[model samples]
Target: MASTAITTLSGGLVSVQASLQSRSKTLGLNLSCSKSVSAIRGLKVASNVQIDSSFLGKASNSSLWASVVSKPEEKQVFSSQLQPQASFKVAVLGAAGGIGQPLGLLIKMSPLVSALHLYDIANVKGVAADLSHCNTPSQVLDFTGPSELANCLKGADVVVIPAGVPRKPGMTRDDLFNINAGIVKTLVEAVADNCPDAFIHIISNPVNSTIPIAAELLKQKGVYNPKKLFGVTTLDVVRANTFIAQKKELKLIDVDVPVIGGHAGITILPLLSKTRPMVTFSNEEVKELTVRIQNAGTEVVEAKAGAGSATLSMAYAAARFVESSLRALDGDRDVYECSFVQSELTELPFFASRVKLGQKGIEAFVSADLEGLSEYESKALEALKPELKASIEKGVAFVHKTAATAAST
Candidate 1:
């Protein structure tokens, strides 16, 4: 039987609290499990560890109970009931930003994250302080500015970067390239120095450029793991699903669209031909839907005016991808999602398609046959490469230029 969490404590529930070892593991204490809790693994507590009876107050609220003892270290399962509780460390760069704030909340709600590290240039400490109050199993920590960046990424299993400016009205993704490019470069460099093998999810704008920038930086550090780097195009897929559901008048959850290629204007390709439940569309409908999916980001930018971009929806989409990644880390071999990564699906070095996720990250890139593509998809795929190629080159050039500048200085 799969490990299961204890969810059915009726009336006033009592938290079975026990002290656990600290981060240093210097102190040793023991606690015996009840006969009913025979599946409890290695029940040890330090002498300094103490149970806070306050946890009993939260019986009505649905939050995982964590030992308040010790700085957040590796997870220790107190019993088999907490089986699916997440024990991995996830660090989010730009955790104080628009998308990061909500994204942090979603991850906090997960039973999978044991520790959550929030890092940003500013405003992050407060965000961490705010999120810490939520009674989740995951412990939250904040690191502000570049000085603390390495500390934030130190032991992360997954590092998510949403650290960049948002798109403005009338601005193409390339328009934000120069600014976001430098940001991604700097952040990925820190990631390289610290958690080189962490599953990297790049959500910076101009992802076509930033993802390549990340790939190259990791290569420069000699720690490039192709299976680990990902450009989150989940928003494109999310939009495709929503729009397709509306167009076909079907239930939203029933819709599934695989968005591929680089994550930008023309490059965002929704494989409408491969939508699940086998939906049908006319040529005209397909054309219109395709265009809408491609331009969905702009729609949000325009709608938000100048205040901000699609923070909430982008947060939702990003959270979806992060959850899938955490699941993959937890040894769920069946977890698969569409993302941009180093690939050979086309002449380009990177492409987005459905990829099977597991302990080793991307186990396989599963793209549908392009030879059997519909006429529109083939044309769209051909036309997208030029802009995408330019973006990729720009990213590669930025890294080389930065390295040269450093060498010169």
Candidate 2:
């Protein structure tokens, strides 16, 4: 048997030697390893020693492996700690799109997700089949066409809609909204009919508008739950954290920036003055960072040369939001994330800011972050109101127009 010694700051040098054999009945893998690092915490072995079996698993079963795998039945007990049980069904709309496929794969890997339903109008079956082969605990199901959409949402605890058209270079928001708004309307209706109580995450572009579109459709269906609706603006926050960390030479993991306002253009606001661990930014630095964060989507789209939009990063951010939402539903009290939802934080009907998530959805909004905005941020906040309000009204108006047209027909 192989042995490895790991030196911890407090534990000095500790030697670990073990021959481990574990079986994951779901994936049907015989996991055997001669050496493993169980745990080292405060000179004592902590029960949760995450194992990396990426290279150890068979080629066919490799997709099933998690970066951190904890087996509780090992003969040499490292510790008694175990992660919380996995419990939640997450449905991903537009699972075949640029963002949706990767989003489905990420969600499929989550131990908290018990079932992942992938729904798209076309080519979703292959996406589902491919994701189903992963060794993760979640069961993957694909739903194709409008006929199967309701079935996909049925019994879901969380419904994430990234299912609209991606923004291409030179495409106006109205052009994007005209196409995506209809898609969102159709999908939100399905969610209302099948999973009215499921936490709805609207990731479709022009989110400032689509979110209102979703809200109105849900209201039409008599299933609108303000607390359960969320517009995933996590990408703005993710971009802000990354850019700020790089510019400030701060540890990325230690940095947190709250992005408020809407999810597009000038509407995305990164509250840099309020960044955790409190970093100072020159006025020029603040302006540059805010512009970059606001236009990060366009930056990616231009870089991709219209090949695609910000699919991967958007997928990652959506996954982060999904995980946070799941954690909140799992009763983890510390879960907080920035999301666009029905709000009174500003005069707008909807806004994006840091929110305390709970089992019942958004439990509270962190309004203090908006209290003391810097001069530039305050001015930017005021400047964005008109555009953000216009987007919200556009979405709300689209719903009413469609309804009126249908009634006339």
Candidate 3:
């Protein structure tokens, strides 16, 4: 006979209810079958046996209360019941490139990822295959060549594009516009189709131009979420912290320098005055630090002596941004990181600043950094708007033209 029991383990109290088989047997048989309580420490088994021999067999069946430990599926169900639903699946487009490979590895290390998808025109199979060996729970999928771009993007929560040609010594982001612009546009089109709601992070440089290009393409697709798109400008902030600490004889880990404005030359504004735990600097020191931060990329380009431009450091910076986004996705209450995004913080169409990240992305823009710009910075900030605006317009125009042609065909 089957019996149900509710037992209090702490006090060793076991209460059981059983529907006993009422046979035409004598009253002595029923009295002798008084439920046996097996004093098992972990599981309490109270058995109501119908027959003499079968009573012991039923008492041994204590699997249900054997241990309160849960199976994987049961644990998952319990966890989901306790926590809110998870959101955000980060995608790395061009995950095979120099920056993308290392960046992809770092992102896979994050606990916030539910799924990671990799897209590239070549060699991505090897990249994905290598990353899949990692112990992290994130599942990596690779899409090779243009044909598979759509599949790579489908259901992505956050799409990061680091897919573009590296900058040569003499070339500006404008020089890269001819080629990288086309690459960014094609991939973003797939994103619009497959995962329109995903937060888009642009790491392909001329980020100053490519970010604008990304915005324009999304606008054309009619799925533009201004808060959802970002240019990964964490590299500038990384450089600022490194350089400021080195010069001032301060600890690098403690220094926090806020780099603002556009990502390129003359436009890249490092707010020296805003350095945390506030240190006062002389006029010459300020000028030197500003120049160093602005030309740090060029310094790397020159120092590599013709090998490459800032791949390792840039990868680290990009990876850090990926972590911040992941943390926000994991239902973190206050995840804020510096990024370049479409903003009205300044007159510029897009500005790089610290933004609070949430479920919907970009919860609040940190304009506190811009409140007390030096006179020199105020002038520089104003001057950057027109050039930045023009660059944005150029990108918007290019996508409109390309999209128009595709529609016609």
Best by TM-score: 2
By lDDT, the best candidate is: 2
Candidate 3 local lDDT, 103-180, one digit each (tens): 888777554565888888888999999999875557888889878888888888888898999877677756788789
lDDT pick, better of 1 and 2: 2
Q: What is the TM-score of each candidate against the true structure?
A: 0.80, 0.83, 0.76
Off by over 4 Å in 2: 1-84
**Model 2 lDDT per residue over 1-409, tens place:** 2121222312232222121111101122323332233431111224344444443443221112222333444323233322225478999999999999999988876556778999999999999999998755578888899889889999999999998888665778678989999999999998999999999999998899999999999999998999999999988888887899899997665568899999989999999999976889998999999999998987887898878789999998888788777767866676678999999999999999989888999899999999988999999999999999999999999999999999999
Q: Which pairs of residues collide in model 3? A: none
Candidate 3 residue 398 Cα shift, in angstroms, is 1.8
Candidate 3 backbone overlaps, count: 0
lDDT at position 121, candidate 3: 85
Whole-model lDDT per candidate? 0.75, 0.78, 0.70
The candidate, 2 or 3, that scores higher on lDDT is 2
Clashing pairs in 1: 5-81, 86-111, 86-112
Q: What is the lDDT, from 0 to 100, of the residue 238 in candidate 2?
A: 81
Per-residue lDDT of model 1, residues 12-99, tens digit only? 2223322221111101122322222222222233332333333222221111233332112322332223324347899999999999
